[model samples]
Target: MWHTVVGAVGLVMGLLPHVLHHIGLLAGTAFVAGSGGTALFGALGLLASVPMLIRLYRRFGSWVAPAVGLLVFAAMFSLSAFVIGPAISGAEGDVTTPSPAPAVDHTDHPGH
Candidate 1:
Protein backbone atom coordinates (compact mmCIF):
# COMPACT_ATOMS: atom_id res chain seq x y z
CA MET A 1 0.00 0.00 0.00
CA TRP A 2 1.02 3.56 -0.58
CA HIS A 3 0.97 4.28 3.13
CA THR A 4 3.40 1.53 3.90
CA VAL A 5 5.70 2.46 1.06
CA VAL A 6 5.70 6.11 1.96
CA GLY A 7 6.29 5.37 5.61
CA ALA A 8 9.25 3.22 4.77
CA VAL A 9 10.64 5.90 2.50
CA GLY A 10 10.20 8.49 5.22
CA LEU A 11 12.02 6.29 7.66
CA VAL A 12 14.88 5.87 5.24
CA MET A 13 15.03 9.58 4.55
CA GLY A 14 15.22 10.26 8.26
CA LEU A 15 18.17 7.95 8.68
CA LEU A 16 19.89 8.38 5.36
CA PRO A 17 23.15 9.85 6.53
CA HIS A 18 23.76 7.41 9.32
CA VAL A 19 22.66 4.49 7.19
CA LEU A 20 24.91 5.44 4.31
CA HIS A 21 27.83 6.04 6.59
CA HIS A 22 27.24 2.76 8.42
CA ILE A 23 27.14 0.92 5.13
CA GLY A 24 30.47 2.44 4.08
CA LEU A 25 29.17 4.15 0.95
CA LEU A 26 29.76 7.64 2.29
CA ALA A 27 32.61 9.01 4.39
CA GLY A 28 32.04 12.63 5.21
CA THR A 29 29.35 14.72 6.82
CA ALA A 30 28.90 16.79 3.74
CA PHE A 31 26.66 15.63 0.94
CA VAL A 32 27.63 12.39 -0.62
CA ALA A 33 30.64 12.84 -2.85
CA GLY A 34 30.50 12.53 -6.63
CA SER A 35 27.13 10.99 -7.57
CA GLY A 36 25.38 11.87 -4.31
CA GLY A 37 23.01 8.98 -4.76
CA THR A 38 21.88 8.74 -1.13
CA ALA A 39 21.21 12.43 -0.84
CA LEU A 40 19.43 12.34 -4.14
CA PHE A 41 17.22 9.50 -3.00
CA GLY A 42 16.37 11.24 0.24
CA ALA A 43 15.48 14.42 -1.62
CA LEU A 44 13.38 12.51 -4.07
CA GLY A 45 11.60 10.75 -1.24
CA LEU A 46 10.77 14.03 0.40
CA LEU A 47 9.29 15.34 -2.82
CA ALA A 48 7.48 12.16 -3.63
CA SER A 49 5.97 11.65 -0.21
CA VAL A 50 3.72 14.64 -0.69
CA PRO A 51 1.47 13.18 -3.33
CA MET A 52 1.29 9.91 -1.49
CA LEU A 53 0.20 11.74 1.62
CA ILE A 54 -2.43 13.58 -0.38
CA ARG A 55 -3.73 10.34 -1.71
CA LEU A 56 -3.93 8.92 1.74
CA TYR A 57 -5.61 12.08 2.89
CA ARG A 58 -8.27 11.80 0.24
CA ARG A 59 -8.80 8.14 0.82
CA PHE A 60 -9.31 8.44 4.53
CA GLY A 61 -10.68 11.99 4.56
CA SER A 62 -8.22 12.73 7.34
CA TRP A 63 -4.77 14.30 7.29
CA VAL A 64 -3.27 14.83 10.72
CA ALA A 65 -1.58 11.57 11.54
CA PRO A 66 0.09 10.80 8.24
CA ALA A 67 1.00 14.40 7.65
CA VAL A 68 2.67 14.74 11.02
CA GLY A 69 4.75 11.63 10.64
CA LEU A 70 5.83 12.46 7.12
CA LEU A 71 6.56 16.04 8.02
CA VAL A 72 8.66 14.99 10.98
CA PHE A 73 10.60 12.56 8.85
CA ALA A 74 11.16 15.15 6.13
CA ALA A 75 12.29 17.72 8.65
CA MET A 76 14.66 15.31 10.27
CA PHE A 77 16.06 14.33 6.89
CA SER A 78 16.64 17.91 5.85
CA LEU A 79 18.10 18.90 9.15
CA SER A 80 20.45 15.97 9.24
CA ALA A 81 21.70 16.52 5.74
CA PHE A 82 22.03 20.28 5.94
CA VAL A 83 22.88 20.89 9.58
CA ILE A 84 23.36 18.17 12.14
CA GLY A 85 25.45 15.90 10.00
CA PRO A 86 27.82 18.67 9.02
CA ALA A 87 28.14 19.87 12.59
CA ILE A 88 28.80 16.36 13.86
CA SER A 89 31.52 15.80 11.26
CA GLY A 90 33.03 19.25 11.64
CA ALA A 91 32.07 20.38 8.15
CA GLU A 92 29.57 23.02 9.18
CA GLY A 93 31.82 26.04 8.61
CA ASP A 94 34.11 27.04 5.81
CA VAL A 95 37.51 25.40 5.84
CA THR A 96 40.40 27.73 5.19
CA THR A 97 43.73 26.33 4.18
CA PRO A 98 46.65 28.71 4.40
CA SER A 99 47.77 29.90 1.03
CA PRO A 100 51.08 28.58 -0.12
CA ALA A 101 53.96 30.57 1.35
CA PRO A 102 55.35 33.22 -0.93
CA ALA A 103 58.51 32.26 -2.71
CA VAL A 104 61.58 33.14 -0.61
CA ASP A 105 63.37 36.37 -1.50
CA HIS A 106 66.86 34.79 -1.12
CA THR A 107 67.88 36.76 -4.19
CA ASP A 108 67.86 39.92 -2.10
CA HIS A 109 69.86 38.24 0.69
CA PRO A 110 72.40 36.88 -1.81
CA GLY A 111 72.76 33.55 0.01
CA HIS A 112 73.58 35.18 3.29
Candidate 2:
Protein backbone atom coordinates (compact mmCIF):
# COMPACT_ATOMS: atom_id res chain seq x y z
CA MET A 1 0.00 0.00 0.00
CA TRP A 2 2.75 2.43 0.95
CA HIS A 3 4.75 1.62 -2.12
CA THR A 4 1.76 2.12 -4.38
CA VAL A 5 0.96 5.45 -2.81
CA VAL A 6 4.54 6.65 -3.06
CA GLY A 7 4.73 5.58 -6.69
CA ALA A 8 1.51 7.35 -7.49
CA VAL A 9 2.79 10.48 -5.83
CA GLY A 10 5.96 10.38 -7.83
CA LEU A 11 4.01 9.99 -11.03
CA VAL A 12 1.86 12.96 -10.16
CA MET A 13 4.92 15.04 -9.31
CA GLY A 14 6.47 14.23 -12.66
CA LEU A 15 3.31 15.04 -14.58
CA LEU A 16 2.65 18.45 -13.05
CA PRO A 17 5.51 20.36 -14.66
CA HIS A 18 4.67 18.84 -18.02
CA VAL A 19 1.05 19.79 -17.73
CA LEU A 20 2.08 23.34 -17.06
CA HIS A 21 4.49 23.36 -19.96
CA HIS A 22 1.94 21.88 -22.35
CA ILE A 23 -0.55 24.57 -21.50
CA GLY A 24 2.09 27.22 -22.24
CA LEU A 25 2.17 28.54 -18.73
CA LEU A 26 5.71 27.34 -18.22
CA ALA A 27 8.75 28.52 -20.15
CA GLY A 28 12.00 26.51 -20.11
CA THR A 29 12.00 23.38 -22.25
CA ALA A 30 14.50 21.78 -19.94
CA PHE A 31 11.98 21.74 -17.12
CA VAL A 32 9.42 20.03 -19.26
CA ALA A 33 11.98 17.48 -20.29
CA GLY A 34 12.93 16.87 -16.70
CA SER A 35 9.33 16.45 -15.62
CA GLY A 36 8.73 13.99 -18.45
CA GLY A 37 11.70 11.98 -17.32
CA THR A 38 10.45 11.95 -13.75
CA ALA A 39 7.01 10.76 -14.84
CA LEU A 40 8.35 7.86 -16.87
CA PHE A 41 10.55 6.56 -14.06
CA GLY A 42 7.99 7.05 -11.33
CA ALA A 43 5.28 5.29 -13.24
CA LEU A 44 7.57 2.42 -14.16
CA GLY A 45 8.77 2.12 -10.56
CA LEU A 46 5.20 1.89 -9.35
CA LEU A 47 4.41 -0.80 -11.89
CA ALA A 48 7.49 -2.89 -11.11
CA SER A 49 7.02 -2.74 -7.35
CA VAL A 50 3.41 -3.83 -7.06
CA PRO A 51 3.98 -7.42 -8.02
CA MET A 52 7.04 -7.64 -5.85
CA LEU A 53 5.06 -6.39 -2.90
CA ILE A 54 2.32 -8.90 -3.42
CA ARG A 55 4.79 -11.73 -3.66
CA LEU A 56 6.60 -10.60 -0.53
CA TYR A 57 3.38 -10.44 1.45
CA ARG A 58 2.45 -13.95 0.39
CA ARG A 59 5.79 -15.61 1.06
CA PHE A 60 7.87 -13.68 3.58
CA GLY A 61 5.05 -12.04 5.53
CA SER A 62 6.48 -8.92 7.24
CA TRP A 63 10.09 -9.87 6.81
CA VAL A 64 10.27 -8.94 3.14
CA ALA A 65 8.21 -5.76 3.07
CA PRO A 66 11.21 -3.51 3.60
CA ALA A 67 13.15 -5.36 0.96
CA VAL A 68 10.36 -4.93 -1.53
CA GLY A 69 10.31 -1.19 -0.81
CA LEU A 70 14.04 -0.92 -1.18
CA LEU A 71 13.84 -2.69 -4.50
CA VAL A 72 11.17 -0.32 -5.72
CA PHE A 73 13.14 2.76 -4.73
CA ALA A 74 16.26 1.28 -6.21
CA ALA A 75 14.48 0.81 -9.49
CA MET A 76 13.33 4.43 -9.35
CA PHE A 77 16.71 5.67 -8.18
CA SER A 78 17.80 5.93 -11.76
CA LEU A 79 15.16 5.81 -14.49
CA SER A 80 15.90 9.53 -14.68
CA ALA A 81 19.35 8.51 -15.82
CA PHE A 82 19.20 5.33 -17.95
CA VAL A 83 15.53 5.06 -18.80
CA ILE A 84 14.94 8.73 -19.53
CA GLY A 85 17.82 8.77 -22.00
CA PRO A 86 20.12 11.75 -22.45
CA ALA A 87 18.87 15.13 -21.48
CA ILE A 88 17.54 17.29 -24.28
CA SER A 89 18.83 20.84 -24.24
CA GLY A 90 16.83 23.67 -25.66
CA ALA A 91 16.62 24.54 -29.40
CA GLU A 92 19.84 24.50 -31.35
CA GLY A 93 21.50 27.77 -32.32
CA ASP A 94 20.75 28.44 -35.98
CA VAL A 95 20.34 31.81 -37.68
CA THR A 96 16.97 32.38 -39.29
CA THR A 97 17.97 35.25 -41.58
CA PRO A 98 20.58 35.38 -44.33
CA SER A 99 23.31 38.02 -44.34
CA PRO A 100 22.99 40.74 -46.94
CA ALA A 101 25.54 40.87 -49.77
CA PRO A 102 28.13 43.64 -49.67
CA ALA A 103 27.05 46.72 -51.64
CA VAL A 104 28.83 47.20 -54.97
CA ASP A 105 31.03 50.32 -55.22
CA HIS A 106 29.25 51.75 -58.28
CA THR A 107 30.01 55.39 -57.25
CA ASP A 108 33.76 54.84 -57.64
CA HIS A 109 33.51 52.81 -60.84
CA PRO A 110 34.43 54.55 -64.11
CA GLY A 111 31.56 52.80 -65.89
CA HIS A 112 29.06 54.44 -63.61
What lDDT, from 0 to 1, does candidate 2 have? Answer: 0.61
Best by TM-score: 1
Angstrom error at residue 87, model 2: 9.1
The residue-by-residue lDDT of candidate 2 on 10-94, one tens digit each, is 6875676457567554453444455575565556666656666777777777856857687757665664444544434332322
Q: Which candidate achieves the best lDDT against the true structure?
A: 1
Off by over 4 Å in 1: 1-6, 25-42, 56-80, 93-95, 99-112
Candidate 2 TM-score, true structure as reference: 0.33
Error in Å for residue 45 of model 2: 2.3
Q: Estimate each model's TM-score.
A: 0.40, 0.33
* Inter-residue clash pairs, candidate 1: none
Residue pair clashes in candidate 2: none
lDDT of each: 0.68, 0.61
**What range of 10 consecutive residues in model 2 has the weakest lDDT sum?**
86-95
The local lDDT score (0 to 100) that residue 99 gets in candidate 1 is 89
